[model samples]
Target: MELTFASYNIHKAVGLDGRRDPDRIMSVLREVDADIIALQEADRRFGARASVLPRALLDDTRWRPLPVAKRPRSLGWHGNALLVRRDIKCLHAEPLDLPTLEPRGAVLAELDLRGEHIRVLGAHLDLSGLRRRDQIKAILKQCTRRGKMPTVIMGDFNQWGRLTGAMQVFGMGWQQITPGASYPSARPIARFDRIIATPDWSYETSGVHHSATSAAASDHLPVWASLRTA
Candidate 1:
């Protein structure tokens, strides 16, 4: 099976124009229209971690956010959320807490798409280099405890080097997709956002979502990839 996956750091719906427009964020999402989306900074950092994307507005779409939020008003855990096609069945969902100085964590969602189980980890690591390494190790350790399957981890990794920093943890069996620079959407020069899949999946096409709206929607442009089952 082939599917398209996207990772976007919405900056909590705050645009470069100094506006928090959830509608504009939604519009950008519609433009990408990926099968599975992993979003970072989807909710406010404080005050109940309230979702930036209106639930009512999302309900109208073919996609649905997984029930991984700890709070009723929050759409994700630690500002990380997963949105999958409504047709895909959710098998399990949980939050993965990382060792960090601030509020930081990840979400793991196991989904069933036409009987094939796919595991996805949506995470936003800390900015501190040391913390990011520890966070990546923790994420990998957690995945090791779970049953093996075709897995993908996507988010704003916040790591600058493509293969020199925290990304070094994903040694073998994992293939990291570099969809090009996605940070500083206006004139992106950093690949902060990423999508990594197990060897069971092969990449077909991948790139940054550079639509006019996306360029200004947030600080980071969305990255997407088309992958096929091996």
Candidate 2:
């Protein structure tokens, strides 16, 4: 089976116009139209850490978020959230704490799609290079602890170029799918957003989801990949 997965940093649902419009973010998501989506900065930075994209609004969408929130108001842990198609069955979901100077975490989920079990990890790593490598090791450890399956780890990696420090840690065991420059949605010069998968899956196509609405929705444009079992 072939499935499309996307990773987006919604910038807390704030656009380049300096407007906080959750609807616009939804519009971009619709345009991407991926089967699964990994979101960074989906929740507010402070206070209750409530989600910028309200749960009520997402109710109208085709995607359902994994129940991995730590707080009643938060959508996911540490601004990282995972969303899968409404038909997908969530087998297991957990929040992971990353080693960082600031509040940084990752979300993990096991889903059953037509009796096919798979894993998804959503993360937004730190700005510091050192912290990012540490975060990757932590995430890698989690992946190793889980049973082998078709897995995808995606989010705003915050890495500037293609072959960078943190990505190197993932090494040859995993395949990195960079859909090109996805940051600064207006111009998209840096590839901050990315998707990584194990050898169990092979990619069909991948690219940045750029459009009029997407460019206005957030600082980082969404990156997507089409993949099937190897």
Residue 174 CA error for candidate 1 (Å)? 0.8
- Alpha-carbon RMSD, each predicted model: 0.7, 0.8
* Clash list (residue pairs), candidate 2: none
**lDDT per residue (tens digit) for residues 1-230 in model 2:** 89999999999999999999999999999999999999999999999999999989889999989999999999999999998999999999999999999999999999998899999999999999999999999998998898788899999988886777878998888989999998788887898889999999988999998899999899999999999988
lDDT by residue (tens digit), candidate 1, 62-95 = 7999988999999999999999999999999998
Worst 10 residues of 2 by lDDT: 158-167
lDDT of 2 at 52: 97
TM-score of 1: 0.98
- In order, candidate lDDTs are 0.93, 0.93
Question: Residue pairs in steric clash, candidate 1?
Answer: none
